[model samples]
Target: MSTTKTCVRSPVPTIALCFIVALFEGLDVQSAGIAGPAIAAHFGLSSSMMGAVFSASIIGLLPGALAGGWLADRLGRKRVLIVAVMIFGVFSAATAMVWSFESLLIMRFLTGVGLGAAMPNLIALASEAVEQRSHGQAVSFMYCGLPLGGALAVLISNAGLEGSWKAVFYVGGLGPLLIVPLLCLWLPESSAYRAQKGRDHSAPTRRLRVLFQQAAARPTLLLWVSYFFTLMVLYILQNWLPSLMMSQGLVRSEVGTVQVALNLGGAIGSLLMGLLMDRWRIMALIVSMYLGTVAALAGLGFSSQFYSMVVAAFAAGFFSIGSQLVLYALAPRFYPTSIRGTGVGSALAVGRLGSICGPLVAGQMLATGSGAAMVLMAATPGIVVAAAAMLLLVAGQHRNQR
Candidate 1:
């Protein structure tokens, strides 16, 4: 597609709308973790059972991302995104009304489907809406909403809501539902997607096949590896951090403080990485990011003092969440507009697998008598693998550019 026809005249409105969707997504994603303890107690759930609850949404995410991306290629980013937002919104609100463990799992799984589907569209729209040179910043800016919304979820959790854990869901659900109208009025379909739609004559199977053909195969595999390991670490932190901190001697209020710090750091890290992604040396930045992640994980493991844990949480959020944002920005560049949603979605779907594993592994480890430090340290090797995969992916992209 021609650059002029591919990109919108102004990306702000599209990116802004996508940001709103992502904000709610972040809230819903973190809501399960924020509300975990109360829900576990209310339902009398064991650690393994609670891990199942955490994995339910992620399991739904795998298919949701796959189908959502496929539909976006056929239907359109805006249409698919709207339906996704609605599905998650209704289900998230329904989460508060669940009367049993099964119902809670059902509601959360449906919410995960919506969240999964919406993410690739957000990345696709944000990247396609802007000039190629600005893709990194555009997607990063939109993605920062996720961590900021997580911060918002933390605040709501602590906001004296009569001890009702359902309050976070109500806010997370209603915000997305309310934003649908705004999206209808303001969000534009990706110009690139529109241009390619009529020309995309390949069948769905063919599109899937292309992901593994010749040069595409390596990056696709590497991206999946990077996503899987990185997300495993991230989801572990997101879902288990509060309980883990409490187990390590922090109070509820202090854990809440660390959660806020973690999220705030995520928001800042996303924007910071966005600015540097397009300008900095790729390999060096990748090294630094992963190294920081390792240090943060160690800090979270060893730090028993309240203030030290808070600092560690911030660093953890900064590098771990920030690395994911960087990956999101990079994914769009590997595929053209026609299959961009599919490519990104497939990557995200694979990442959700790690997401599912993270919480489950943490739960099992804790249930089996692993310490918080042991659980935290277990993630280091995966970080090393993710960093290596990303470096190779970047090297390939540079070679292609040459």
Candidate 2:
């Protein structure tokens, strides 16, 4: 099934667009966390309530991803992506208008839906733009926007927002709207999608019940389990690291700097590993990355000094978040383009659910009077388990191919 391969003369433009959308997702995903203090202060909320708010968008993301993927497979990746960007953009901007706790929760949940819809389609589009073998690097390059956006969120919140948390939402929200036209004008639809549509017009509109088809069932289950554990640890840190550090007696001001380091490490590691993935045994490389994260998490558990914790955080981010990005790069390869969006979206839906559980679970762990160090140490093994799942996934995938 040959596509109108002319939709992409090069991968750069497509990647750039996906990168921008991913950046928006990153910003909004981090928006609640970065603004956590302000939001709590403004609303006079409890830790449990804050946890609910933190989980709101992520919960919304669960269904958003499922529906978005199903639609993108049929409606067109570009169209789905554009609508997704708009959904998040408008909702994020509306976030600034919330005057109460419940209002903020609703707005964030709506915004999450938009964010969830955009990601899988962006992943699918970017992978489709490049040649098969180069997909690892291409999708990795595209996902770097996530970490970059996280870094930018910290910068924007502290450097530019001037203490008003609403300012951060304003930037995270309306900024994506301005990018929509550029996407319409420049970002091409997935040529692979077009080819699939050409072959069977009816296929595009079908529901996503096919994820468990005989050929896909094993990888799908493995992908879901791996995604669940990885996202659990990743979001636990993303949402709670500052609180954890503060609980341990670290200076309050250093939190932002440490977050920047963590995200910077994620960006660097993602690019380097992306290249290696195209050339190495992907399971071995990914497992090693998670193992390094386990060690870093252990380091963070014991580190009493400021600089050491920062270094440990950076390594944790470098490996865990970076490994997750590689999984994004790898997702499209496991399924045919016909259901690519569903495959990736399904994997992420479970992960998003895990993300919702992550912060809440961390909150509960802290509630039990556990020290930050002990909690982190306990969580490290979850990532180890996720790495094991990926090892099995790679073995099953290889066996299936043969």
Best by TM-score: 1
What ranges in model 1 sit over 4 Å off? 1-8
lDDT of 1 by residue, 1-402 (tens): 656555227888999898988999999999998888888998999888989998999888999998888888989999999999999999999999999999999999999999999999999999999888888899999999999999999899899897568999999999999999999999989989988887786776888888898888999999999999999999999999988998998878899999999999999999999989889886888899999999999999999899999999999999999999999999988887878888999999999999999999999999999999999999999999999999999999899889
Error of 2 at 95 (Å): 1.7
lDDT of each: 0.92, 0.84
lDDT of 2 by residue, 1-402 (tens): 876744337778999889988888888888888778768888898777878888999898998898888788778899999999999999999998998989988998999999999989988998899888998888888888888888888787777445568887898998899999999899988778888875434443353556776778878888898888898888887887777887778664687787888888888888888888899988789778988888988887788888998899889889988889877887788889878888898899999988998888877777778777777777776787788888888888788779
TM-score of decoy 1: 0.97
- Candidate No. with top lDDT: 1
Between which residue pairs do clashes occur in model 1? none
